[model samples]
Target: MSAAERVPGQFTLVLHSHLPWLINHGRWPVGEEWLYQSWAHCYLPLQRILRRLADDGYTDQLSLGITPVLAAQLDDPAAVAGMYEWLADWQLRAMEAAIDDDPDRRASGHREYRAAAAALDDFAQHWQHGGSPAIRDLLSTSVMELLGGPLAHPFQPLLDPRLREFSLHEGLADAQLRWGTRPSGIWAPECAYTPGMESLYRDAGVSHFMVDGPTLHGDTALGRPVADSDVVAFGRDLTVSYRVWSPKSGYPGHGAYRDFHTYDHQTGFKPFRVTGKSVPPAAKKPYDPTLVDAAIDTHVDDFVACIRQRLIDESARLGRDALVVAAFDTELFGHWWHEGPIWLERVLRRLPEAGITVGTLATARRDGYVGDPVELADSSWGSGKDWRVWEGPQVAHLVQLNREVTDTALDSLDKRLPAHGSADPGADPRDLTADQILRETLMTVQSDWPFMVSKDTAAGYAQDRAYKHAHATREICTASDAGRDARAASLAAGWRRADNLFGALDARRLPTRDWSEK
Candidate 1:
């Protein structure tokens, strides 16, 4: 289709990819497994799909938000090496399963074996060096605009202003180091927002970020710049996003799609289809790749038509060009929903063919999709579309823990480190100490802990991680306050090695006073 004949409405698909600091933390059913599974299934496959589209001259096809914490993991030498080993183990497991006595299990094993082998091969070719190179290659194509968020993916609204500002700056810097440019937009952790956060975003050099549709009072068809700021807040259109995956209904719930929760006890692989919501894992039918392939096509067509009709209806209602943004976690594609990557590839390719103008959030902003400025309320994409999930009774303890740790860390750092000029110029001892404090504080502030605890999914692990980091921060601060320079330095270095993200973190960037107040 000619440029002049293109549709008036724009569709922007935003995938917010994030995981808390899990490296060197734990493995099975939680930490490292989560990272490797996402890496092998989501990141690698999505990269292949986007790279393919970019090679074919698709520009700004989507907006991918890779949180700085996840970026650090992707680029970590330890993580890359660990993932390589994990993939090898996965292949071996598949090989063993392929020889199972049960024909159904054997067939499933073989299918898994092929997938493992292919993922291993792709990892060797594109990801052997580290994720930085792979991601840099994608950025070079400009087919997808990268969106970055604060270090550790903190709930920004509840975070201390000093730490919040520091994390945001450091996070953006991390992205720049890896990709050669800083992202102008961020997927605010959990799509959570508080009033006046936009001013902080503006100061951080961010031009836009995402919030839930209800955060914009449910009129999410157009991007709205925050009051008195150029930072545009793009609201995710639930009507479209939920059509793919939601609590009650979505394509992933189809009987043909791989079941996310049910897994074979012996091999630990999901071997059955989502036969029914009430179906037992043992009773559900075996997964068939062919059936899923057929289902993908059906869902693809359904989604395309949904978008087309949405654009047509929205454009008519607005009497002008409209924008519909569907944002989701990147893990939903290949991790939670096994057929997500294929579905993504088909959707990207089919959207333009159907005359819908697919674009990145950046492109939408550039094309004047910014509607009238408005004051947004305090909101999040969580339950009740508010901050209750993060700060409610279920997780109030975790919230208090975060607040205490953040306050203690900041207060100690301010006292010890002071500012650059105020402190001794020649290799201040407090720099390393301050760095450690911030690192532990950031990790403790990660939104994952509260979310996991609140949802009762891996609650123990989440609580443990949160307290572990908090304890580390407190211990380091205590050592420093006692003037035990040797002990403090030793403890700080040890914790640094453990957390080991944001190596470029500068404690001096942490303001002594709240910059937001100024």
Candidate 2:
């Protein structure tokens, strides 16, 4: 019998792929390195698995959200060239490690060398052009559904309404340009929501989106319509998701898995197994591929069982066929967990064989896995399941800066650009001053800065990025407001060279009135 016929419920996996604009930014600890590492380790490997699954005749196995900002970087010429260079450097380092003085380092180096070689070949064969073609190919195969989000992945619940609408429209448009399809669903930046945003989503032609389970008051057995709108809000099932990625417990922490933190300082390779929770880096055992194979098999079985049990339980509890969604950041696979991609492919393949139905969020919605309309409160997937992470006292200064910059940019554009009904408002699509102001403003409002600051992961870098963009926005707006056209043009040009993404952004389309106040 088919999996859907055997099971009383369905399961959907969502992987959100995102990174703030990083090209021309700093490298090393917190910049382009992030883009290259995730590209090489996570995106490449994950897509390969999806491609194989498609060949094996799988369709709608999961939903993949690629933020427009990340998409822009993925398809950018400069970023594409830089990623290739980074992969070449990775191969060189692996070769150096293969010939290291220490036996453990040499063993790790050989493993890394082969992996690097494979990655280089994959890039040359598929990703050399840019991420769009590779992503488009996957979409064309129907292996997964693509989810789009607003420009720069801003916290929409806190964003000004006009900017919120503008960002989403532009983001969907950007996706259409790249993949020739506009996503009807979004990952909803941070899975954050506030009252009345659903109307804006409906207006933008979005049909479905995601939120934390708590945002739906923990009733996650099905998607819910938000506040009388036809748009559906799918909540992540914490029961299944936390099994693989909670703060304290997860499959990646298993003793036999490769330790992501314990690096070989000499060769910059992670050369040790987790061994034990209490074990120090120096006391950890050398990584063994054989151990990882067994560990992955064990975890795959455990996860498959967990999903099967949950589906059965939820179906019985609801007195109807239920839906389960497990969403996580794409970087968790291969990049952070090391064995994540293998585990993912195995779980996806095994679930259906085990009498469990696996499908994408869109499938769940279309197949009648929807419940009642929910009056969702302000919520996010952040700490406390609230907006504190992006609006807390820790990031009070950033919050203030975002508001100030947004206002300055909006006020300047209002004065400079013609209104919607004015004479030939579309006369020029190239408003360098307005374009640059909006660009900087969008960068300033990205949810990453506040998230990093609240979590204290590279807080300094996050703070610097937020303030730097805010400062740029203010300066350009000031120059344009003062009729210093040349100065404003030069500043906009300089900033454009450094922080260029979203080539389709036009300030003329921004709403003249602040709709949030209404």
Candidate 3:
């Protein structure tokens, strides 16, 4: 297994960037404010980092998945308003903190806070197009792979067939709207999968969707097809993903990095480190960006070298070329791990230098690499790389909600769907009203809403996003059920104005299965 017979050392790096639907909604926990913070800290910073790389001679290929829910919030006017307000409040909080501490330290905090606030404002304005255009241009040129998912980021397999179909339809359609190209790949909201999910992706025109590595049954290290569907399921290489961020130990646990949880509420700035998760906040070390940057350089080198070795070894062991995939949440960078963006840049830089080719699932599938389809184990990229997080005790309420809401919503739509496949008349208020109600209802059952709620970390934003989506679904259904054509249309239109993510969901695609109890 020499380099000559190892195919092209090509691999795909997929970063899933998503947030629940948070628009003119809540302030703390899960609300519009949370959206702004992530935008300011993660999304905006990440875009800038990529922009810098693109502006340079680097054509290092990367794939990004921005869910329809996140896209909607980023592009919403009310969401922008909430972001601006949050920034302003953050500045005010910093000012107050500056005056209460030692003069020198207080002044330094004030300066840093002001600078952060200004950067946030500028990033917001620069991203007026929801940062969609820049991403689209990158995809168009092939330096970046643009990926999309459902209207509300639902786990299709867990959803009722009807709702699942509608969500995928709308989600794929939304990708077309943002990237100016229909994506052939999908980043399942949680990398959650079941055997029948491949059928749904095929119906939505997706060529591939990600799955956890262990999900691919047996010793097949690369991607394998589920059932007989044309869609390919690429498994995440946990060995690689865990290099930077893992459930137990990763770079984020480094003692020099800024603490995510113990921020100074008075100043709205984090100036400490998690010396030990078990240690009290007062015992943690002072956060130092410079020290963390040094650490990142070391870790980045180790990861790149490790990848190079893995590629070499796998190509040797398999007696054929191999592909390795590393998938992660895009927000982990600037959002959860403050130095994440810096680490990413360092790693990307090292990849090309180390002779590794960056490609997306689109290119991977296109390159004729998929072979020997196998039965995939039902799994997710969660705790234990399985569905425990989703089906765990902490989140049973969410599971119940997912089952009930979807069941109820589908029943409401099914009883009223145009009989015998009657064509929807655009001019008839009742027909238009029904279509919109069914669409919203279908989008609501997306599993992402509740999974986020159950996590408790992003609990605030998750609950609000779920409730808001749920409310929209109910309102539309309630109006339609009562045959209030004009009222239903009005409410439907209002929802569209607030949350028009994708226009592709049709009531006809709702799953027609006997597992209504699921």
Candidate 4:
């Protein structure tokens, strides 16, 4: 630690890695294909970068939140098999492009071929069993702090308190089961929070969580304890974070970087650089890796300078040491922005050199970077920094469906099962039926469907998923209610083959409550 590298404040890079349960759903555009793409482009490459840094003796590089549902998919046998096939196909496509008549296409093909081959080799070495081994190794080596979230990534603000607690408990437990240690902090789904959510955090043993800056009224210079709880809330410093990627502008939009939207239909690869925002895909230049080095170098320097300046400015503004947390979706790195991993590595390396302290959310809290408690209102990191994205008029039906399914699930489970923690842990047929019902019910209320519908991105798929899960929950519950135990068990077994996840989830954990009080 050099004196020149000392800063008055700390900066934490938080990346929330999440995706809904996609296996046994659809395949292309929005399902298993989505999982395989992210696995190759984002998860594989991202882990390799962290492993390299860890091998070089870097620890606490960032906070990574892998939601329970996403982890389930990553560790699933079917997904692992599908990912290997996808990588093989990717290599074949690169080979086909390498033989193309167009010079540019051939060059791009060669580059992709090497990339695909390397990815396949890496998967075979580190991820053949499942993502858990690699992820577990990362945690064990202290490469990054793992932040857990609720099962299925439900939008907590709009969810019932009972289900929210169950999800959080099981979600953290799932992380422990996979990684051998439970996470004390979480990247709350969407960074969504209501006034009383902190108490739930306290109850779940969560020490901290992230939220958007506006949710804290932009006084994001320090972490604040929500309400009177010791559980702290860290706000994303938009000024520093959005400088890399935002709704309209970012380094990825630079003409020299590979464009995310322009794809070679034949090869299923993005083959063009972002020549200009107005340029059509046909007019865009072929992607050239040679141009990316300079872009990454320039952007990394700019980002390092920005973080240095922000730390200095924030410390002076508050007349005390400060904190700047920059959070983003983990997929935004290699998946959305081709050179993002390169830029991220450079930024993380340079910030410490530039006298800007870099650490995780856990480090910030443990080091006493917390401020006074705040009574946070209903909020999320979505459009308008509120809950409209999940509860808006456009998705009114979903909001209603979430409520109805949650209530129905509780009622049905309570009538059949003993009180919480009282049921036997054996694999009884009725217990399996209850588990499937609760699983589908949880899937129905996941926040992704409404978000996709509201954003008009894959709205059809989103609606279909929500309805499918809801209908499954209702059908199973109907059989159980009508004393058709055999039918209920059969449906549950069928669903389990497809939706099997969260082996720790049991209906016994969901406490039976008296509805008359409500």
Candidate 5:
């Protein structure tokens, strides 16, 4: 078929990349390791794929949401240095594994050694400086539309209105500083939303954001502008998204796929395939990279077919060209499912060949695929399609904790620092103290804590992080109140160095008054 005679619908691949501020916090099994693993396995490889596409002249082929918190870590000098060391150590570990006693272990070790070496080479070549340069290059080429989010990945629904507005503006400013262009789209953290947030997004210069499929009452074939707001909310096409990864089953569950849960104890490498659902990790079959190649091919075919059929069906139903947005967490690609990057590359390349118009969310909007306006209820991408995960009985305390911390941080900042329009604008000591308090407060209100607690995954560590940030906020505020400027400065500097994600944050820009009053 000629390009002009192809299907009428468009397909958008949206990947939300995020991780909480984990630098200088903890190392193995939970904190910095998570960052390094995702960086090495997901970010580096994904960018490599995108760069190849860009080299071939793919423009706005996909939309990538890099939350401000994640971007800060990627651009941090200390984090970059640490990641280099981690990659070097990974190479060494692979070398040791190649000399193991068992034949299967040795074979797996050799394979991993090659991968580790390649990753090291890639890091030195493209990422030795920091991730910002590479990310900026991608944006410049227009290979992908960058989607920026709030300062920290806070649950916007439960956060105070003033703090929410502040985070949105600051987050966009950070992205603009790094990329030299402000994003018109965002992947709202967790795809969570409340009524009236669209106006805030419009005010912040965001033209579009995402929510879950069910959030649109299961009619997610096209983007819908919320009531009386030009800012559009794109609903994730769950039918198409779950084909790649879902809670119950998906391509990542294939028997030939590397088992994410099964790892070589000594080498810290995943050495086995999923093998069987009931099989123990020790009993699982050894991983074979060759087997995964065939599986990726099959999954790629399956996924492309699914997307093609969905677009056709939805276009027919809508009586016009429709849009199918398949959104997922970026980490799921190379971090959770080892073959995900390969599958992604194949699917992206194959879709265009099949005569499907593949483009980013921005392209979809610009092409006039928006549907009738709708008033969306409060919802999220979590289970139940509501706020139960972050606000349920299991995480009620965290909800309250977020409230208290936000209130305290804003109240203290107002009391100690000059108001927004005050004349004392040039490098005041009060501004420094207030900035630290706001930083700690933002860190404390990250949505990861309640999410981890609700899922019972690393509950202890999540609780510790939340309490740690909250305590830092309280201590710094207390010192400032007592006129202990030196002590407060010391505490603030230490916390800043420890969890310094957003270096561009300035407390003076935060709204001192409520949004309602404005």
Candidate 6:
């Protein structure tokens, strides 16, 4: 809209890739193995898009945050094994369909079989063969910037202090193991934050993080620098993000986009497009990806314009280049909205040509830009872009449990700190039992649980995850203090069996600095 903004500079585009650790777990209704589906549809295809861009000499400056739990599953031997098993199974299913007798049915089945076989093969080479190192190659390619977060995607404000520390430390360490090094920016698991959390980030070496625009109040359009710490907090440019996939009325809601729900019972494939806004699922058109590609181009153009405008206004208002970061769950591109990969490819490809400069979060901070904080209110990137999704009535039990378990862990850890005031320096003070319970507690407190429950997707599993972890966290804190080591150990072991995730969380990896150099 303005000539000043067009004087080509840098803008940040951060995308968060996260999923509950559903490796060999979660089935059917709630689970749907969104992981591999997301990988095939979104992750691998998106990676290919980035590769294509790189090939054309257009390296990505886009920021990508992958949660540690998700990372762990990505790097796990079990998960890798399971993925291949699933792919082979899919190949077999496709073969069966290809041999169907009916003419029309056979043609459809043959087409699907070919697509499935292609996807399975792509996944093998792109991800499975080399493991997560392939992901590291992408990040290291100068085409993309990577971000990390807590071990599990937890509701941070309501997590045990020890768990928070443990998770972040282990999470960052896991990133180093898989993708080759630590990330200077973190996604902060659902964009959940509290007053003191920034200090933890400072302690852990994270210099930047992102939150929804509403969380920073209605004032700022771009990311702002926070007080008490140097960590820059980027806010999601929702107006742009929603152009492709908003909850109610984004392009994905159009008649031509693929339907996330309503899978073909016989093939476990979603064979239709939205085809109608208010129409029932039974009456949708067959999904034609070709039509969706044309729609993506139009929507993507509008998004670039929106970001360019935001950068112009913010740079002038804040007296420097301002970053307009549009963040979203990585799953949306392919897993949730079937044609998301197409939209993503179109957006990324069109950015440079549109004269919109995209840079990584770390690069944005390094290049010098800051926002004076007026105030930051409670918020999130949820339905209203607020906390209601995690605190609403549909998740009241989760709310109560979060409060009790988190507060209990905090109080217990506080009391234990005094004992370490003069303790031996080399002692293993990392509370393993507390850490384990807190890990489960943190994993269970993921905002996804409440959101999933609210949306009625396996509400019971969500409830059970939250409550069971809350119980373990509370019981461990109580039992440990009472010298009930046996009971504490029993509870910790039990929770590990049920809420197990990120087995690589060795206590040795915890960062020891308080407020010094991260």
lDDT of 1 by residue, 294-367 (tens): 89999999999999899989999999989999999999999999999999999999999888999999999999
Question: For candidate 6, lDDT tens digit of each residue in 39-73?
Answer: 66677777888788777777656888888777766
Residues 334-383 of candidate 4: C-alpha lDDT, one tens digit per residue: 99998898888888888878887888999999998999988988999999
Best prediction by lDDT: 2
Tens-digit per-residue lDDT, 220-281, candidate 5: 89899999988899999989998888889899999999999987887778889999888987
* lDDT per residue as tens, model 3, 95-137: 7767875653475477667756766667555765556765665
List candidate 4 segments past 4 Å from native: 1-5, 420-430
Q: Among all windows of ten consecutive residues in candidate 1, which has the lowest summed lDDT? A: 421-430
The residue ranges of model 3 lying beyond 4 angstroms of the native Cα positions read 1-8, 88-104, 107-111, 114-125, 217-221, 276-278, 384-388, 391-400, 420-432, 458-479, 486-518
Q: Compared to the true structure, candidate 5 yields what TM-score?
A: 0.97
Clashing pairs in 6: 60-143, 255-275, 333-340
lDDT winner between candidates 1 and 3: 1
Model 5 spans > 4 angstroms off: 421-430, 514-518
TM-score-wise, the better of 2 and 3 is 2
Q: What TM-score should be assigned to candidate 6? A: 0.85
Clash totals, every prediction: 0, 0, 7, 0, 0, 3
Please give the distance, in angstroms, between residue 480's alpha carbon in candidate 4 and its true position after superposition. Answer: 0.4
Residue 377 lDDT, candidate 3, scale 0-100: 65
